[model samples]
Target: MTTNLILTNSLDEIAEFVTLLVIFIIVIGITYFSIRIVGNIQKEKLGRGNIQILETQKVSNTKYIQIVRIGKKCFAIAICKDSISYLCEVDEGDLQFNTDSSISKSSAESFKTIIDKFKKDKPED
Candidate 1:
């Protein structure tokens, strides 16, 4: 009878520990999801602005061109690492894109082409 009582006490302690662990897990999950939901809600509320980016194209390593729409007019702007400049006004019909995929066919090919070009252009030592 004493052994059975000890076993029953140990089992109750283990069951209480498991229940506490489960409660802690549930609390942590709730806290994580609540924070995530609040952050997403704040981001969505802050994203309602008048200026919208329509298109972007990278010109070089440090230069890019973007078309942005402000209210009713759209303009093209050039962005560099140092400064941003207004390029020109963009009409809807003036947009053009290159359909060829030869520029970035593969990462290895692009690297190899760049190295070859540098070697060809390198001054004699």
Candidate 2:
């Protein structure tokens, strides 16, 4: 009967949809795990080296100032797109390190608060 044919067609379509969804989810999970594994491996390799970037500040689109630690010594360097120049040797005692984990959250909250204040003070059209 046509009724049975319609029911069978819908079931087949549903099964195909479910199969595709499952495949998509599996692919996403595999990609996520692979990325995480690669990242961990890279971090481990980088941490084993004596040269480490302690901090970096962007000066321009193609320029930056970076504080780097080479073994027991720390230096400030200017990095341009084409070259790197040594600025000066930084005294470790004068440098401040942020130990706060909620800095990003606090900064986001402050930005949101500023936006809300701006909106409140705006003139109505």
Off by over 4 Å in 1: 1-32, 96-125
Angstrom error at residue 119, model 1: 45
The per-residue C-alpha lDDT of model 1 at residue 23 equals 100
Reference-based lDDT, each prediction: 0.79, 0.84
**Which has the greatest lDDT?**
2
Give the poorly placed runs of model 2, Cα more than 4 Å off: 98-125
Q: Among all windows of ten consecutive residues in candidate 2, which has the lowest summed lDDT? A: 101-110
Candidate 1, poorest ten consecutive residues by summed lDDT: 98-107
What is every candidate's alpha-carbon RMSD to the true fold?
14.8, 9.0
Candidate 1 C-alpha lDDT tens digits along 1-125: 99999999999999999999999999999999999899789667746767766666789999988887787787999999999999988885676544455342333445667879999999999
TM-score, each model? Answer: 0.47, 0.75
